[model samples]
Target: MKAVQYQNFGGPEVLEVVDIPDPKMFADLVLVRIEAAALNPADLAFQSGAADPLVDSLFPVTPGWDLAGVVEQIGVATAGFQPGDEVIGFVRGQAMHYGTYAERISAEPRQLVRKPRNLSWAQAAGLPLAGLTAYQAIVHGLKVTAGDTVLVHGAAGGVGHLAVQIAIAQGARVLGTGSAASQAFIGSLGAIPVRYGDELVDEVLKIAPVGVDAVLDTAGRGSLSTTQALAAVGARVASITRSSTEYEGAIDVYARLDGDDLTRLVELAEEGKLTVHVDSAFPLGQAAEAQRVLAGGHVRGKIVLEIREEV
Candidate 1:
């Protein structure tokens, strides 16, 4: 089997596709033949040694967390998944090491979610991490509901786009912030688009005279003041990028892997209520190019590495 590995933390140039031994099936874990993998900003940070404090690295590292694959083998203890079942997984753990950017991966049953029939392998590959973050932040952290006005910062980016859709699905009247280039894309997701910057607060206030019921900030350029000013009298605020308490009165969210949560996201995608945009895709061995695309930033959705044909 072939996998992308980096011996030292540095740039995308460090990524190498090498022939490695197939992963051994561990107890209580299922083995999957990976079809596709998606790259995230955290993958770049960890590979470049920037996430050193948050992620303890084990060298000869394979850097990826989002995967769409088919079950090749199931552990004796694992239930609910059988061989040949199509599945998606976040594959994140307490430590960084072996991952999904390979021909094969072993995952715990708790990490598995049945893929929706409507999604292609590329779309399913993009959903796990970004979808999970948006789900946790908007649905759990902010408590957005029908008739509420919600604002999503960085609404054109990966997680922000999903957050916008989830808020709309919950029946909230949403106002999303993005650059001029992304305003139309933001509005297409059923939200009022507000170009972010000096005019963010004003645009939001113009759309909702009473202010927004909740604010989700994915752009961490000190947007606390804007969110505070745009908040309704008693609004919940959350930020995925700024997890520090220094931000004040904001719930700093970190995405966690939950099978149940992914299942709901899959249901929405299958029902055509949510969308996962893939900006570009590279072949499996071209993992370096995929990272380069993600590092460029402002991609409409996700960057995926298509490893093999989906069964």
Candidate 2:
């Protein structure tokens, strides 16, 4: 199998595609022939060694987590999936290695979900990590409910855009923050678009009046700091980018691989309540270029690597 791997930590420059031996299947893991892989900011952080202190690294690391693929082989102990099943997964583990960047990956059953029939491979590939983060933050962390006014920072971004839609799906009135360029895109997701910067608080207040019922900050840059001023009394707050200690009451969320959670996202997508937008896609050989594009920032949605033409 051909895979993208980096022997040392650096920027996109460190990545290289090489022919590697196929991964061996463990008793409890399913082997997937990857069709697409999505790039995330964490992929950049992990490749740059910024996440070094938190996770151990295996040299020649294959950097990716979000994947959409077809099952090529099933483990003896894995029963839910069978050969030829189409699947999507967040393949993270205790260490940085054996990622989904390759043509094949062996994943635990709990990390895999049946890909939504309505989504293409690229869209499905982009759903796992970002979708999980947004779903967990808005639905679980903030507990957004019908009639509530929710505020989402970076509303047009990869995670933020999904967060906006997820909040709306939960029946919350959403106020999403983004740049002038994104206002239309933000509003299209069924949220009231609020511009970023000095007037953000005013913009949100103009719509919510008494302040938002919950705030989800997907864009860091001191976004959590505004929760005190933008949220209503007793409002919940969650941040995927900031630290819990950075803001007194905000919950700092890290996305986890949960089969149940991914399945719910798939249902949302199937029901047309959630959408995964792929801003761009590159062939697997261009993994490094894809990372650079994501690192450049301001991406409207997920960037994917098309591993197979049929995808």
Candidate 3:
């Protein structure tokens, strides 16, 4: 089996494709032949040593969380899936190791759900990490409800695009912040586009003078300024990237892997209410380059590593 591994924390240049033995399928875990793996900002941060303090790395590590693949084997106790089933997962364990960027991965059944029938392998691979972030932030963290006006920072990017749809599905009126170029994409998701910049606060204010009922900051760098200004009294404002503890009256959400929670997202996609836009894809061996692209931080949607031929 071939997998992307890094010996020391650094840049994308540190990654290399190496041949390793097939994963030892363990009891209580499902073994899948990798099809597609999606890149996320966290993968870049962890690789660049920024997230090292929070993660305990064992030197050589495969990097990725989002995955869509075909199940080849399952532990004796695994009940929901059989060989040949299609699945998707947020395949993170207790620490950094044995990720989805490889040709195979053994994931805990609790972290996976059946792939949505409507999605291709690339789109399914893009769903777990990014979709879960938006789903949890909007449905749980912010508690957005009908008639509420919601503001999402970086709303045209990976998580934001799905967050807009999740909010709209729940009947909330959404306003998303992005560059002027993303206005049309944001609008297409049924959210009012508010261009982000020095004028961000003013643009949001112009749309909702009374203030927004909820704010989800998918964009991490210094987004608090805009979020705080648009939040109405008692609004639940939260961020996925930064700690809300640093900001007063804000929430911080860490995306968790729950097969059950992901089912709702799958259902939405199958029903045509949710979709993943693949910003770009690189061959499995080009994992290093894919990390570099995502690290640039201006990506429009989920970036993926394609292992199998596109479906």
Candidate lDDT values, in order: 0.87, 0.90, 0.88
Ten-residue region with minimum lDDT total, candidate 1 = 241-250
Stronger candidate by lDDT (1 vs 2) = 2
Task: Please provide, for model 3 over 1-311, each residue's C-alpha lDDT reduced to its tens digit, 9 standing for 90 to 100.
Answer: 88899999899999998988889977888999889999988888888888777879877899888899999999998888899999999989778988998999998888889999999899999999899989999998988888999998899899999999999999999999888888998898889998878888888888889899998888877887766677788888889977576468888888887777799999999989999988899999888888878878778878999995323
Q: Write the per-residue lDDT of candidate 1 for residues 145-177, one digit (tens) a residue.
A: 888998888888889899999999999988888
TM-score of each model, paired residue for residue = 0.96, 0.97, 0.95
Residue 76's C-alpha lDDT in candidate 1? Answer: 81
Candidate 1 segments exceeding 4 Å error: 243-247, 309-311
What lDDT is obtained when candidate 2 is compared to the true structure?
Answer: 0.90
Model 1 lDDT vs. the true structure?
Answer: 0.87
Local error of candidate 3 at residue 31 (angstroms): 1.0
- Estimate, for each residue in 82-165, the C-alpha lDDT of model 2 and write its tens digit: 999999999998999889888999889888989999999999999999999999999889898899898888998999999999
TM-score-sorted candidate list, best first: 2, 1, 3
